[model samples]
Target: MINLHGINCPEWVSIGGDQRRFDDSGKPVDPSTADRAERVLATFVRLSSKVSA
Candidate 1:
């Protein structure tokens, strides 16, 4: 996990079909699922920061 501001963002997030994983940098373990993973890690950090603020 990567700590952003005060949130503990997960290093890998399971998303979309088959629950493909995406790293904290938004890189998918399987390149084929890249489109599905998106930048969810960044999104979480952004949203969490807003909530905490």
Candidate 2:
């Protein structure tokens, strides 16, 4: 895991083709796979804020 809860990763990248998403047609959906990146980034920010508070 890349510790997504601790960093903002908005780009979808392939790592040995194991970190990719697939569509209903069994094809890779590269662009849509990073949708959670922003959410993860937001979570990190929230957690950090709590810790700093």
Candidate 3:
């Protein structure tokens, strides 16, 4: 996990059994997929922080 402005960002994400994705830099193998995943992760972090706060 990585600390991003107090948000704990995962190094990698697992989609399902034996289907782990993302690299050590937290980027998906495919550029398009990475972009989408980044957006989703950012939204999740934003919402989760708001909820916790």
| Regions of candidate 2 where Cα sits further than 4 Å from its true position | 1-29
Instruction: Give the worst 10-residue stretch by lDDT in candidate 2.
Output: 7-16
lDDT of 2 at 41: 60
Candidate 2: deviation at residue 5, Å?
A: 16
Per-model CA lDDT versus the true structure: 0.62, 0.56, 0.62
Model 2: per-residue Cα lDDT over 1-53, one tens digit each: 35754644344334346447567896557654455554556776776787676
Query: Distance (Å) between predicted and true CA of 33, model 1?
Result: 3.8
Q: Residue 20: error of model 2 in Å?
A: 6.5
Model 1 Cα lDDT, one tens digit per residue, 1-53 = 23544655555455676546658896677765664345665677777887877
TM-score of each: 0.37, 0.41, 0.48
For model 1, what is the alpha-carbon lDDT of residue 46? 78
Clashing residue pairs in candidate 3 are none
